[model samples]
Structure formats: structure tokens, C-alpha cells
Target: MWIKKFTIRGILVGLVCVFFLSPVCMAELPITSSFGWRVHPITGAWKFHSGLDLGYDYGTPIPAMFDGVVVQAGDFGDGYGNQVMLYHPAMDCYTRYAHMSGVIVDVGASVAQGEIIGYVGATGNATGPHLHLEWIVKGEDGGYVYADPIGLWM
Candidate 1:
């Protein structure tokens, strides 16, 4: 399928960008939880966490990990709270910023790497103020998958 092909190309492009581009400029927020299957903090049930929970004071600015255009910006009541999703055409991947007190970017707006896109907050199934960051990639089956982001911004 076309989606599969595009995803494959995206993976290659992402590798090249990772090697040739400047280091990712992420905020130095403390990671409270990492990506993977784990016990849910709220429900106490086993679940797969799709992102990193970066703990910080309320209203702390959250930065974009790569140059991208905002594709979605708003609350959908999906347990992500006020969120921003960016599509990095160069890498053919998407990054998500969630649980924000505020979103500064609008849909379709271009954001540079490290630009402040939102603020941290305890929204949507959160216990405290933090930013839930997710790196999303398209799988070979043309479905989306979560990528561990510990190495990308650490």
C-alpha cells in the first residue's frame, strides 16, 4: 500500500536526519514515567504507556523535538488533555505534546525545533503537572506505533 511505502521512506529519512542534523533540543524536564507496558498510575491496571511523562512545574514550557507543522491543536477529551500533534515532513514522523495547561501553536503553523509549543499541566488522567510526549511512527502494516523517545531528547 502507499501508506506502507511512505512509512518505509519515512524511516530512512528519519535515520538520515538523526545522523546529519543538530542534536534534538528538548527541555530538561524530569522524566517521571517512560514508554512501555507498565502499571497505570491512575487505574492501577497493566497498560502500555505510549509516551514519556516529563514532570515539571505547572505552566512550564514544552518544546518541539523537531521542525514540523502543527496538525492538531486542541482538547478532544481523549485523556491527552489539551494536546498538540506535529507532522515533521522531513522525517515523515509525528510528535505529540499532551497534558498541557496551554497550547501556543495553532493547527498548520510551522514550528522550529525546540520552539515552545505548550505548557505542562495536570490534565487528562494525570496526577500532577507534566508533559506527556509521544513519538509516533507508521508501522509496516500502515498503522501507527509508538517509539521510545528516551534516546531522542535525553
Candidate 2:
């Protein structure tokens, strides 16, 4: 009887740890592809990937990693379909969410961290459904530089 009680307690503790310690609880975004140089899946040409790809099921709600205002939210009509761009004033940076099937926010809307702003999908020059996330910071030359979203944000 003592062994059974111990096992049950251990299982319960493990469940609590997993529930509270998981990414879902940690507010971490799910990433499918990383940023950097890689051979394109369709083009097969080596190039610098400007963003990290986070995937969810088709039409899954995408959360914002930080509080920001929506600057651009719509289709690029080419490489980035149904995208949402947010400008973070505190960070002095811009975050882009590309290749979305659907977007829920509009320009000038304020979004809180972990708030749903769009849905995941394979739009634009993508092979499957995923959120192409990009971090943009001001360059020394006044232009914007793209960075990997992995570890940098979530």
C-alpha cells in the first residue's frame, strides 16, 4: 500500500512539474525552422534565411511575444501572404509574422505579449503551414537588420 501511494504521488508531482515547466506555461513560442543560411527548399539555392519558422496546425492562433503595435497587417501579395508586422517601441525593433493563412489584427492595434494576433498557414513562398518570424533591429547604417527569433525572443 505504501509503494502504491508513493508511485501515485510521484506521478502527480511529475505531472505538475511538466504542466508548470513546459513551454506552454513558459510562454515560449514553437519554432519549426531556424534562421541563417540554408539551401532553399524549392529553389535549392543557398541563401541567408532571415527568420525563424514556427508551425502550428492550419489556422492555429499565433501569439505575440511582446507588447507592440501592429504596423502592417495584411498580405504582401508575393513572398509573404497574410503577414502581420509589429513595432515594439520598448525594444526599438520590429517583428514580422509571415506566411500566415489568416490575420486577426490591423494596423495601429496594440497587442500584448502572448496575445493571439494571427493564425498559422503556408502562405507565400512556403512549402507548408508555418509562421515565419523575423526580428528587425536598426542597423548602423540606419537600415534594418534581420535576426533569428530563436533564443532572442522566446
Candidate 3:
């Protein structure tokens, strides 16, 4: 009887561990394609700009990084143009896609990883067409802190 009770308690503990760890293990963003280019006519410099720049003439599709709720979506007016901000509870992180031509998701909407959320564009303070992608960690005072999106992938 003692051995059986010990085994049952171990099993329960294992199950609880799985439940809590699953979400952290499951956050990721898919890369469709990436390209490095010389700064456009707007910004004349061949600085080492990293990150995959998905190019489309118009009406290109952009996807979400992970399964999360849209905490904010609108024209932020900070050179981001029409942007979408997603909060991933599982990852305990947030993603910001900026300079978008259009936004497909709404605030409070649940989106799966790699799901279409917006299209690329030159808006806000952008000189050319591109998405200023950023990964953010939760900060104190209900604010978000920025992280290098390229570094996150690396």
C-alpha cells in the first residue's frame, strides 16, 4: 500500500509539470523568406541591416508569430503606421509588426502561429516599404520592453 501511494503521487506531480511547461515549449515564429538589400533610395547607406525582409509589390500576406491574443491593433502614429501588437501568454512575450499597409486581426482576437495578421507597407516614419518587426518582453508598470527581433531568432 505504501509503494502504491508513492507511485500515484509521483504520477500526479509529473502531470502537473507537463501542464505548466507545455506553453513555454510551444512558442515560435515561422520564417517564410528573408532577403538582405541595400538601403533604398530613401536611406542611402549599405549598413548591415539584419532580419528577413519579405518583399511584395502589393497585397502581400503577413502572418503571426505565435498563438496569442491581439492586445492592440491600430494606427499608432509613431512611424509604425497601421500596426498590430500580439501578446503570447504561453511565451510571456509580445510581438510588434510595424509599417503595415493593412491589418486583418482585431483587438482581443485569438490568432494561431503563422496566421495572417497584416500586410507589409511603408507607413509612419518609414522611408520605404518594409516591416519593422520587434519582439518585446513584459516590463513593470504594465509596459512592454523591446528586444532585438533578429537576436531572438539567433
Candidate 4:
């Protein structure tokens, strides 16, 4: 029912907090790496970095940035390690948290903003403990596009 109301207008205004994260959690964390093109930390070649890496202590709790359904959870062996992908219909977008120590939410579960979905870890290709966050929206061609998530989360 909620997906039926989707529109480009929704995506434009979606950053307005249809749901809110815990006030004290993310604002204090430092950004270890930003999104976009850069030299790979693990690899020697240049590649596009799809998400923002938030530096944190190992096993730190990770919260959902918006109210959404957990469309995916667990390690898919795709190099993301233990991850959680949430679909936020209100924003006409999805948010992904990767390289997690553990995933607490399961696929299809509805999560509120600020819900602790997982814990931080140096999983997958990561060199150290951090939370890799991605903001993805649909493109005009109806394909998924990884947008810079810093504007929405911070």
C-alpha cells in the first residue's frame, strides 16, 4: 500500500525525516572515508566507493537511518560481509549497512529509524572496524543508483 504512493516528488522531499535517528549516535562519529571515486584501500587500483565509511569501535551498534523494511540481511558473500539492506518507501530509496559484525534484523522485518540493526566490524574487505553506509535511489531508467548518503544521514 505504501509503495503505491511513490513519486519523484517523494524522492525530492524524502530527506525530511519521515523517521528520525537517535540524536546522539551518528552525529558524534567521524567519517573515515567519503563516498565517490578514490583509490581502493585494499586494492591498488582506483574504483568508485559506493558508500561512506564511519569510523567506530568494534561491535558498535548501528542504527537504521529511516523507517523501512529489511529487504536483505546476512552475508551474501558479495564482499559486503554481514549486511542489512533496508527499503524506505517514503524516500523512494534504500539504505545499506555493510561490513557488520553481526546482523540482528531479518529480511522483511519493519524497522524504525534508530533501531539497532547490527554491530560494527571489520568484515569482508575492510581493513578495520567501521560502518559502511549506502543511500541508493532509483534512476530515471528505473535502475538503482548509489547516491551520496552523507546529506541524508548527517
TM-score of each: 0.78, 0.75, 0.61, 0.80
Tens-digit per-residue lDDT, 1-154, candidate 3: 0000000112122212332333322133323323234454345766333233434445566677677899989896655688898898986877777778899999999998778898888777566666666566655545555543434333
Going through the candidates in the order shown, the clash numbers are 0, 0, 2, 0
Candidate 3 lDDT (Cα, whole model)? Answer: 0.59
Which ranges in model 3 have alpha carbons more than 4 Å from their true place? Answer: 1-57, 139-143
RMSD of 1: 6.0
Pitting candidate 3 against candidate 4, the one with the higher lDDT is 4
The candidates, ranked best first by TM-score, are 4, 1, 2, 3
- For model 4, the stretches where C-alpha displacement exceeds 4 angstroms are 1-29
- The positional error of residue 71 in candidate 2, measured at the CA in angstroms, is 0.8
Task: Give one digit per residue, the lDDT tens place, for model 4 in 1-154.
Answer: 0111112332322223322332333465478988887899999679778888988899988888778999999998888999999999986789889999999999999998778899999889898999898878786677777777665543
Q: Which stretches of candidate 1 lie over 4 Å from their true place?
A: 1-29
Estimate, for each residue in 60-147, the C-alpha lDDT of model 2 and write its tens digit: 7777757899999998676888899999898687888889888999899999877789888998889999878777876656666775
Candidate lDDT (C-alpha), each:
0.76, 0.71, 0.59, 0.77
The collision pairs in model 3 are 79-124, 79-125
Question: Which pairs clash inside model 4?
Answer: none
- Give me candidate 1's TM-score against the actual structure: 0.78
lDDT of 3 at 70: 97
